[model samples]
Target: MEALTGCTRDELIGAPFKNYFTDPERAETSIKLVLSEKKVTNYELTARARDGRETVVSYNATTFYDRDRRLQGVFAAARDVTESKRVEEEIRTLNAELTSANKELEAFSYSVSHDLRAPLRSIDGFSQAFLDDFGSTVPEEGRENLERVRRATQRMGQLIDDMLLLSRVTRREMHMQETDISALAADVTGELALDNPQRDVQLTIEPGMAATGDPQLLRIVLVNLLGNAWKFTSRRQHAHVSMGTVRDPEHGPAFFVRDDGVGFDAKYKEKLFVAFQRLHAQEEFPGTGIGLATIQRVIRRHGGDVWAEGEVDRGATFYFTIPDLHVSCPVKGKQP
Candidate 1:
């Protein structure tokens, strides 16, 4: 058998097959893996022929014993898969092209939405101005109808704005650079302060910390995280908000926004990041529900991620990452 199959049949007669293809140290590790897998001892592998050519082989080898329960020799067989491998490479190339096309389409659709927003805003604005200025001259019930029309137009306009923003997020090119996370937080806090000067809230931002990410996108991320923190904790006795970063292996570094606000169940964390998805009633919290969805897109574009943790009436901590900005991505053309 050894002479026919080029195998040292004497060596294979009793000992384990590990002494063959893989080295001693590797064989021990491989054997442990096999034991842990608890699968049948049948697998396909590659080996070098006597002519030094590579051949794919399949073998079924197992433990054996005599009627006395004593160990016995193992037998093996094999098959080749060189043609199968050639077909697999062709399929992989096709799949890669398909993925590239899909990514291009997503980017294009986003740009188209952004470009259409300006015209929609003008139409809504002019209709409102005309209704408000000339309502007095119109008939009583007719004027009321015009006011309703104006309000409806404004609401639709806001919805369009949100949709456009969400689309632009997907298309926009992220400009990665050294970004001051604390400064972005502080700036957003200040803006929130100016927006709601009457609300006295204690906001703490850890200074001297930074992240590598696009400044503009980071602003959007900070605005959503901090703004949610501010709004949800608005009615608290003494509102508190904190911003800081934590170490991560896969994402490098992660920044988080913490607040003592009306938190939610952890079960719905995934839903919170989806577009147009909201967990709270509109009356409790006024929002387009596009914020977190946009945040998810931004983090992903930077090769990062976002997640949240909270309890009902306790508070929520939102964690997000910004990839190292120094790295450059090729401007591969994307579709609309």
Candidate 2:
């Protein structure tokens, strides 16, 4: 009691235990329960020190008896838990604040999706209508300006949609299960091929690659990565894209998507996963620059990390690792 409560041994030797507690009522109730039950574990109270400082403590007590089995007194041990209690309270406060912040973010995303898009839609709609209704009356330069306005509104609409998707990915509840990543990659590739039937591209996906995660969110990851590969490889004469898994010594099982495309400079890799950060000009490679950011958030939510490696005009490979997956075997050679 002296060491735990900062009281002198002589002061605590004959003092009532309840008298040392900050809340005597709670201490009395706990003592009664211990007496009735014969033992009590982890009964918590605030103990006041001799200098008037208070500390949280947990007590374990049991009734002591002699050969006749009649109750004699209580034997107890106290552990100071003030630091642990403080840490727990801090964690609870941080969690509450984070939840409140997420709610506000969701509300803002909702406004962007609905309130902002309505006027953008009207702008684009009227621009198109004006072009259709008075194309001959307007000068060619004026018609081109209207077309530019329509395109800007369309791009803004895409940005809003992507922002909403990013917000949803962050807050959506995950449903974890075994997912066939190879099949998902193949499906996304097939869709890409259908969208650009004239383009010549070769896509290779390693079979039997699987992991444990939310299938929907994981599919979005694959779509964004594979879509990026497909988009960047558009100018390649012999485009080659591959999706596979590898074993990382530090991060466990990792997945990758490689592309022989117009790869970016490695020096700018740090900006790849940041929202609205673009390394390429829109005319060179069109994107809203939110895909990689969204992919990173989804992977992080699944207890994973995403990274990329590339050289200017050489090629690029994106890698991501998912935790808690039972990797069957490691890839034999170096990663692409």
Candidate 3:
């Protein structure tokens, strides 16, 4: 170390070098860069001594040029960051621990699913029994009251199922593969047709679309996306819906679900992907309200993203991305 700085090797070996450093690689690389292309750049590395003491530093190396553009020895300035790096690593470890803890909590919540549903069943059964035993004696309004009790119990059961889904999504397996987006969309459309055959509406899907992701989770995402599209666009005489992709120069490619129906305001976009958040009235739209939240979670778990755009009584488009490795989605092909 001292030899490089014009000092005796023995003296440089034991000096307070932990706070001082010189990167020969930085010097060499800088020299080559200036001679070849002449640019300023920086890099980080560690320097260790014979005694095992070490220093971490980043070298911001630059080339010096004479007014006539004559070559000069590259000058390097280093910033000691051993402590900073240590703290940064500590922060990263803490964050990882926090994420794991969050997952564990979700697992714990899922475990409660078994315990939670039993009581709802008891309530529902008891309510039905009361109606059956005293139906002839009970007034019409009294029978109606029992019906409401049964309805409440069923609703609570549905809520527990929703909770389970939300937790499972947090720790679900992701298998990435090539998928045809158009095929998946077509399959969803066909199933919706069978599921709600009475409804008279047009469901149009663009062709030749593709993507890469976990097929299972992506199917859930599509089901929710298309389901919402179908639900919101129901009011229209001829529902307008499209599925395709767009190229973003800086951000690569993004796939989207476009629909003309009951669109929401831009202000609530962020809240759309949150659990149990519904922008519309329950009377107008019946949902457990966790669909979008689950869709967002699956998308994120696959290392992708999701966003939406819309306005009241206008239309909406939701754009999201997976890995773009494969694509799959066709009507008769409602995922196996």
Candidate 4:
């Protein structure tokens, strides 16, 4: 009080309480409000010093009573919030600037992808034309070089597409609802089988598995996981893949996808969810390395968590949870 009003205790003791405030009427009304409301908290006022300086103050006041239960007076405390308020405004300004910068970066990425792809398609198209027009005239090595060029172009295109998808995953507006995890897994697995009919993989989906999330995003998660499972187990004579829900001691229920495939090293599991980070050689298993990163973003947006456990050459399991939602729901039968 002495610092705010620039008055000693002796001068403050019997002076009009409102005189030290810029808005005397509001300051006086604040005490009356406490008497009626029993208490008033975080009431804002501007304290005026004797040197004509002002400071922002927050007042918390309560009504007091005498021994006979008669009204006595109001007891109030004031705190300077000038620095905290300034910091809050600064944070708001920084957040706005950050949002603008992100939008600009996203736009730049899209423009670069579009410009690069045009030339890439032209190169591939002309290379194919050359092969078609002068196939016999060109040497075998020359033809192989042309094919390599085409392959590189195709791979670059795929990388661009995947990068765009990863960007969209973070910027997309989510629509949360009760999603059927079992049905989504079944659909994704069925698609994988159709795409590679030669592979005889045993797939199991626990029936009635459900959770709350964006259904479209959740489907992408299943497609990426099940696709990886199917790809990694291509060499196994007896491959097995399954999806189910398990109760987590720390985070309620979690949904899991398990695969008896060429699992990765557990020590490097953290790399699994970082964009463009890969564990295995590109020749061994082909991928853009954006799948798990996308899955982590989706789960996090739903206020949940995702993790993995695996051992090299053994198998792997991925687990994710949606906050406060159950994964076990009753349904008719199993999906295989």
Question: Which 10 consecutive residues of model 4 have the lowest summed lDDT?
Answer: 327-336
Candidate 4: the clashing residue pairs are none
| Top candidate, metric TM-score | 2
Better of 1 and 3 by lDDT: 3
Q: TM-score of predicted model 4? A: 0.76
Model 2, range 48-164, lDDT digits (tens) per residue? Answer: 877888889888999999999999999988888999999999999999999999889888888887799999989999999998999889999999999999989999999988988
> Which 10-residue window of candidate 2 scores lowest in summed lDDT?
326-335
Clashes of each: 2, 0, 22, 0
lDDT tens digits, residue span 1-336, model 1: 243235676755875555444234543454454444533354655554344555544544444568996656444454456578768888999999977986887776656556666666676677667767986787888867766666666666666667666777776777778987777789999999899887878988766667677899888888888999999998897888988766545555567789989998889988998888888987788777888998898888888889888999999998876555221222113210
> What is model 2's C-alpha RMSD?
3.1
| Candidate 3 regions with alpha-carbon error over 4 angstroms | 1-103, 248-252, 325-336
When sorted by TM-score, best at the front, the candidate numbers are: 2, 4, 3, 1
Score every model by TM-score: 0.57, 0.86, 0.64, 0.76
TM-score of decoy 3: 0.64
| Regions more than 4 Å wrong, model 4 | 7-43, 48-53, 59-79, 248-252, 265-267, 311-313, 329-336
Using TM-score as the yardstick, the better of models 2 and 3 is 2
Lowest lDDT sum, 10 consecutive residues, model 1, at: 327-336
lDDT (Cα, tens digit) per residue for candidate 4, span 1-336: 889999999999989989999999999999889988999999999999999989889999998899998878778898998888789989999999989988997897789678979999999999999999997899999999999999889988888888877777787789888888888899999999999999989888888788878998888888888898998998898899998877766665778889999999999999999999999888889888988998999889889999998999898899888885554464223322
Give the alpha-carbon lDDT of every model. Answer: 0.72, 0.89, 0.75, 0.87
What does the lDDT come to for candidate 1? 0.72
